[model samples]
Target chain A: MAHIVFEQVTKQYDNGFVAVKDLNLEIGDDEFLVLVGPSGCGKTTSLRMLAGLESISRGSLYIDGQRVNEKSPRERDIAMVFQSYALYPHMSVFENMAFGLQLQGTAKPEIQQRVQAAAAQLGIEELLDRKPKQLSGGQRQRVAVGRAIVRDPSAFLMDEPLSNLDAKLRVQARAELTKLHKKLGTTFIYVTHDQVEAMTMGSRIAVMNQGILQQVDTPQNLYEHPNNMFVAGFMGSPAMNFFEATLTQTGEQMVIDAGALQLPVPEEVRSRYQSLLGTPLIFGIRPENIYNPEFAPPGINPVAIEATVSVVEMMGHEEIVYFALGDGHEFLARVDPRSRFTPGESVSVSFDMNRFHLFDKASEHVLVS
Target chain B: MQDASNIMRLLGAIAAIIVGSGGIIALFYVANLVVNRLPPRPRSQILPWVYMVPALVMLGAFLVLPTLRTILLSFMDRRSQGWVGLDNYIFAFTNADMLIAFRNNVLWLVLVTGVSVGLGLVIAVLVDRVKYEPLAKALIFLPMAISFVGASVIWRFMYAYQPPGTDQIGLLNAIAVALGYEPIGWLVNKSVNNFALIAIMIWLQTGFAMVLLSSAVKGIPKDVIEAARIDGASEFQIFWRITIPMISSTIVVVSTTIIVLVLKVFDIVFVMTGGNLDTDVIASRMIKEMFNFRNFGRGSAIAVVLLLAVIPVMVTNIRRFQQQEANR
Candidate 1:
């Protein structure tokens, strides 16, 4: 197993389109590094470049500190699991898993042992003689993974491997993949557009957008401290709400004037935004942080904002109330499921001031403590 | 009102059928009278006459009677009314010219069909990945548009001989002269005439093979190729191992098609060489014996042999087609 490093690697296509721009990442040995982003965000392109399927336009790629910019995929000793499960349809599962070893001229007995071991580990021992067409989607995916496993390469590159399966199968395979990674103890560089997969599986997640890496951190840290507005908005479901607010200092107290309501800033938040006093700032908050007045924690400052509920979506565990503040500003708040609220009802929602995130209005950079 | 109209339409249909049947019966009666006057019936107890009538009539008119007449004419002294058995077959199998024709035909079958299909497969695989593949294929397939006779005429000028002196008008002789060499006769040389004719047949057939194999190559799934590449197999190995096996049925079908054409090749050989200078194939020899020399029995024997040679290949082709369909 080896640590794979991309040292300011860049990929520019012949058509003059930049796919990845100065991507610098160091994936440590035996670590699971996930590259996550929306579609066309260059995550897959970066993975392909590391696999040597795509040519690196500039900068060096190193595996175990050896520069592999000029190496072929086979020469790099890396195996990839494609999104389509690109299995050899004509070959049985045994041959599919044994192909790379056979190409390397491994002895027949050794190939058999390795292939059988991989099949057993993948729980596909009974499926060794079956063709890929005879297997289900999940089974084919496992066979694809097994094909990579028998090689025992320095790193495993998976490009959205579980994206083709149904949701339940994807979830099961996700857990199984994590277990397999731990068992094998090899560095894995996985690429997917699914945020949840990255959040749940990776040792560290690299969020990318528009061919640029936005943030790289642990999933919990990413959730709590996104670096910019895009990362903040992209990382969450029922995403963080943003409102244009004016920061003002009145009598040694800092307050933000949201158009239809004025909210006094708590001391901790005030200190965090002390550098941006008197400057306009954007206030962001997660839906779960906004609560009904009865559920507000004691001794915490609550910024109560009154707005008419425009729509209420009753999820089984909670209710999401879409409320319209004046001047066409709208946001949602997750509240208790049993809360009595309806569309056209004016309700007082309290924002937990401790959880609110403040960002510079012009730069969109988070105003951090 | 609807019943009255339906009855009138039914009467009109019955009237038309009666008129058609009346005309057919009149014609059959006249034909029967004419047939009865020509021959008396043989009394056979076990053989059913009615069942054999239509088949006998057709065979006599088209095949059996014509064969008998040809055999008779082959034995007779050219006017035809005597009997001789095995004489025409003996003359056909023994003649030196006939032996040369047979040799030339075998050479044509092996060289023309073999080289064209081989070259076609290589070209198909090479250009399958090229940009503007459709345009390349159309250019290659353009020659198939020229009729065999037309192609023969076109190449005749190309193979035209111009001896040692004077400005060469033929394209090939011009190149020879320009290269400071004596222009040799391409089609008239006994040693090279067969090759020249084979070249014409190859020109006509390679396009057919390319079109067939190209479609077969395209039908191989992209994922299979990617899988083979990711397996660390080189490009050449992938071609031989994955591509050839996948398109084996198409190769068989195309090879059989060219074989059939090779067996019946006549137009290019006849138009270019007129069975002269060691260029005679089976079809050309059949034409020479039957029409040019009026050797009917020998020609018919050659025709039968050619048919016998082609039947097995045709049967295999049909079975291969059925197997392909069943696979689908």
Candidate 2:
């Protein structure tokens, strides 16, 4: 319903501890934007400041083109689902959802109608008479969402609403929440420390670390085109392998001179990175990009490197082959399920240089996004 | 003679209750007849109060009648022959000994309630999850098992003082002597003795406050408070609007309980100081005026004043209980 804009927003505590710093993000209207990071990464602080729960120490926040820096939370017309679900323990589930509407002085009949409708929508019609203590955790979370939905706010601010649920329930609730967001068509700003949740839920994720914004991009873009070393290493499982290598001009092509092996820079990106020739850079590649020479994709322009397989994790669909080059830097390659490579076996692993990632040695900033 | 009158009063009270119930049933029948003029549902609401007539009548006899009689007696002459109007009240408030009693009662009310509740809250918050929390709480709560008269008697010996040159017999004075200080007279010193008695009340009542408030404090989940903050409640707003409302019944129960007990405080003062050397309080003063001096008018006035002081707190406690029931 509303596009949220954070223009250099900073949240510094009164004790001079900065929770969030110089955040500049534009969340599109009706977008499910997830702010994901480790604990103390300021994702929750950013969400809190957006909800007007915490004050923005600097900069401004615009919701639907209105600067809401000085507005109280009630004045901002946003509904929030807390990690604890924050139901009025004294009230019945019906009254718990009706509370905000009641506080706004909505008519009793209208409040009842909306609450009943929301409860029915959430499949909690039977729970309407129950107090929060009488319900299970998943039911409480559903009621929390139902409470937010009943108000029909301009946006929904969720601060780790699913983290308290058990793993299976969290997964089920994640899909339910996505469906709810689509049904409401309201902007959903969710904050969490779970990367998997962020990847599964967010239309666009803003990754933060130590009070600093690291990257803001789609899940696919974040995995494919990380803007810095931190983002590249943080997004993928079995994370991208890195090596300290220098770029060199070799007979009409550019290649990285690793200590004991030479990795060719792909022709498509060689010219683009020619200016950094002979300069030290970090060579990076995803585990999925490396394949056994025999199992390499038909047209991937694979560069073969001889390495000994140190470990092989057979994942049914594919094999995760842990191998090491002569210089002793270990790497993981996701090869075909049919691969017969075993530990201590020398195999030719193919690097798909088309998906190569590079970062500046000193700055750790990505050479290409 | 006292036992004979007590039995006679018991027979009189039974006869009054029988007559009272009959009168209440008659009153309710008439009220029901009048309310029957209204619509059925509205009459239904009003009819419940008709069912309460028995209770109201009993309250009128046992509570309201005695309160009215006390007020009436507060204005009468000592011999119950002529009206003295405000003379008894004036004497109750203006007399030197009576003023000292009022001052001492005020000191008891302020210090006893504040220290007990304050220390109770501190201990409750700090003792949770400690290694021997139940043992510690039980130890602190043990004083409540002792009757006020017994507690005062025990504390009286503890506060016993001797001259500096003599070996101290009391625990406090003995400690002082061992610590190489002069053995000060704890009970004989007016200011010190009043506080000494006040400390016993605090020691006795703090357990009551702790047992109730601690449970209330424990009932508040951390996440709920966080939710309030996110729900737009400021820290102060959360404390005042949410936290206070959630535990208000407990707070009211504890406060009014201690307030009512302080209003009628007599046993401790009588046992420890015998209403002497600036230790006189309203209830003790009333008893002394009525018995030792045989000044019934002044004593009735003091009793009336104490009843007046306790009424609001009692009403508040009843209201809190009613509100809690309403919520349920």
Candidate 3:
């Protein structure tokens, strides 16, 4: 097991398209670092550079302190699981697992032993003689992982390994992959466009967009404290709601005056926005952070926003009430499932001011507390 | 209704029978007059008939009738005026030139087919992933565009002989002269002249093999290749272990095709040496016996032997193609 470091690494294709720009990351040993982005956002390209499939156009990469920028994939001692699963379609499961060992010139009996062991670990021992095409999607994915596991490489680079599986199987495989990572205790750099996979699977996620690294943090930290508007908008489901509001001082209390509504800001928010008092700022709040009046804590300064309910999505455990502000701005508020809110009805929703995020409208940077 | 009427009318016509029968008979005449003079059809269904009529007539006259006649001639004496009852077969078995030609044909079949296909496979794999791959393939495929007679003429110039005192203008001799070596008679040296003619056939046919095998090489899925690479297979291991196995069927098809072509090869040998100097293949010798010497019986025996030699390979090729289609 080894830590992987991408130090100012960049990848420029032969056609002069810059796929990854100055990517610098350090994944510690046994850490599952996920590179998450939308499609063509340089996540897979960065993972390929780490896997040594694509050449590093600028700067160097290191695995356990060894500079491997110019090394072939085999020489770098890394195992990769492709998004396609890429099992040798012609070989049996056992032969597929034994292929790498055989190439390394390992003894025949030893190769068999390792292959069987990896097969057993994957619970595919009965499928040892079956071709990849004969296996189901999940089994093929496991075989791909088994192929990498048998190598006992310094690190595992997976490029959206579970993307091909059906929804139920993807969930099952996600848990199994975490278990496998725990069991192997090897660095895994998984690239995926699915943010849920990144949040659930990665020990730390590096979210990227347009070939630029936006934010990298633990899943919880990233969710709670996204550094900028892009991160704030990208990380959460139903995304953070944003509205233009002026941070004004009203009788020594900082108040946010969004058109047709005004609310006293929390003391912590006031101090955070002290420098930007009377300046226009973007107010961001997650749907889950906003609630109905019954759940609002007493003595906590809550901002009451008047909105007309446009739609109510009745999820089993919670209700998502989409409301339109008078000025035509729309936002969703997660409320108790029993709340009887109807469309076209005006309601006052409590926005927990302490939990809301404020960003400088000009720079789009979060105004930190 | 009109289409059906027209088809029926065409099929039932008195002129159809006369024209068809005359076409068949005229194909046997030396001139190829009526066969080449057929008119083009306005419609596609009629077009197939227009093209197939000439081929059918030609096959009936040259291949079908001649094969039957050769079978009859095989049982006759040299003069064909008298029946000799397996006398020609006995003659073919005992005759030294006929036996030598048969043996040399077998050697040519093995060497030319095996070497050309093997070299083609190597060339296909080597240049398959090169940066200038199209350019390289075009260069290799260049020799295939040259007709067999043209290739023979080109090689003849290279193998041209000059006495020691005379100027060495031939390519091989000039190269030898440049290297300060004595000029050798490349085509008249009987021990190596067979190989020289075989080289021309190989040169002409290797390009066909390369083009076929190159397509097969490209047909291997990129995923399978990348999978093998990720399995830690070296480039050489991938080529041998993965690539060769994947394209094995194509290789067999190409090899059998070249073998069939080799069995029928006559132009290179005939043009280069006129089947002289220990270089007579079965087809060339059969032509020489029939046309030059007018020995129908011996020529028929050689023709039957060549047919027999080719039938099994053709059968195998057909079966392989059927199996490949079934697999698809």
Candidate 4:
């Protein structure tokens, strides 16, 4: 078990391109921390710095409180599973898993025992003698994981290990990896650009953009209380919708004036934005927060607005409806599938007043998170 | 009578043409018919050899027969009149000039193969990471395009000697004279002539070795090397454990090819020094014995020795290829 820390770590290439900047992250022992971002977002660079694969340009890294900035990867005592499942093509599966142990000069009997236990754990016992090319992609993925397991290192670093598998196999492998993490209770730091994988597997997800950390929080917390516009839009599928609007105080309540529609904020949450009463702000709402009036759940403080339904997607349990307002502002809502809303029909949708988010227009930071 | 004889010759020509082309077709047709009439088990057993007959016949006539004749002549007199029974072999092994040839062949085998492959592997690894890799590889591999005799001629000018004289024209002598040292005769000096000849062969072959080895080095995936580093392998360990084994097959191919080429080394020695001044090798000596001295028995004996030396290298290479195919 290991607690890994990146203290203001920065990576700058020789050509003056900064791949990662001022990354500060603390991963506790036995925690499955996922570094999630889009392509070229520096998540992989940060992970590589921690793995000692890439050099840390400006700041220090610590593993169990040891400064390992100058240490080589071999001295770091961490194992990584590459996205390609980089098994040695010339070696048998057994030898592939035993390679690290052999390098460390582990006893023959112990190496054999550890390798067998790992293979049995991964349910790949029958594939011990087969070469890497002889195995299917999913089997190779397991062998890559099994190779890391045999090392019994303090941490496991996985760089998009499931991205190469087919869709169905990726889902299956995702669950198996989570179960394995829980069984081993080792610190797992996984890097991927897939948000769904991040949400499903990470104990806590760290989101990054443009070489900077945007937010680090639990999956539920990140969805319910995102810190900025990027996080709110990035975390959920179909994304959160935003409207350019102004907030005004009316008597004792606050109202959002979004040009096309106006809705009063809930009395309980009104005081959170009273100081910015007449300032232009951005209003945000997730797809799930908007609902069809007929099937809107009770006690959500629903405020009704009229719009024309442009398209409807029936998803068995719910419908994803695209709505266009009178001012041409468009948004989507996940409503109850039983409500038969169709295209070209005027429908009244309810916005949960308590769940709406307000952000400062200039900074795009949450005004009332 | 003349017209009658001409008519008869034309008829005979027609008969010969018919027998030549039609005979082969008819023979194959009848053999196919006979094989089709047999049971399936015997038919399957006989079919492959039937298909192999033409190639096997050609090999037997061209290769097998000549080799047997050469062996037979090795035991006979110079004119192949009577059985001399190992006298030529005794002369080949015991002669003073033949001993020098044997020693020089061994030197070529060891030094030329080792230096060429070693230099090729080192250059391949270092050049792969550079930005101007293609240009650098092209420059290094350009020497392979030159034939051995052409390369020897180029080096001959480089090694030309000018007897401690005024304004030496040879490149080496000019450098020595410019440095205030006496001009040295490179080819005439027995000590340096063999080495000079070997250097020419190395120059021609290192490029061939480099092209093969560079591709082999590049064939290893980058991730495998990175994984080795993360698995706690030092750089040296990674090279030994991952890089070497990954390119072992290519290395074997390059080495055996160089060995075969080095064993039959004749062109450079013949072009540069004509095997004089203690620079004789097996192939050049065999040629001299056969053509210049008209000693067929001694030449055949030397040829048998060269064949014996090369057989194991070829056999090992074939086995390696078969193993790789089986794995695939």
Interface RMSD of each: 2.0, 2.7, 1.6, 0.7
Q: Superposing every Cα of model 1 onto the true structure, what RMSD results? A: 10.5
Isolated chain B TM-score per model: 0.77, 0.77, 0.81, 0.84
TM-score of each: 0.80, 0.64, 0.85, 0.81
Off by over 4 Å in 4: A249-253, B1-103, B130-139, B154-195, B294-328
Candidate 1 chain B minimal-lDDT segment of 10 residues: B42-51
| Model 3 C-alpha lDDT versus the unseen true structure | 0.85
TM-score of chain A of each: 0.96, 0.93, 0.95, 0.97
Write down the TM-score of model 4's second chain: 0.84
Give lDDT tens digits, candidate 3, residues A59-137: 8899889999988777878888988888876689888898889999999999989988998999999999998878999
Q: Which residue runs does candidate 2 get wrong by more than 4 Å? A: B1-219, B229-241, B248-328
Can you tell me the CAPRI class of model 3? acceptable
- B319: Cα error in model 1, Å: 5.5
Q: For residues B171-282, what per-residue lDDT tens digits would candidate 1 score against the true structure?
A: 9889988998888788888878889889988888888899999898898886567656666777787788778888988999999988988888888988998988888888
lDDT by residue (A31-96, candidate 4, tens digit) is 999999899999999988988889999988999999999999888889999999999998999999
Task: Specify the CAPRI tier of model 4.
Answer: medium
lDDT score of residue A108 within candidate 1: 99
Model 2 Cα displacement at B82 (Å)?
39
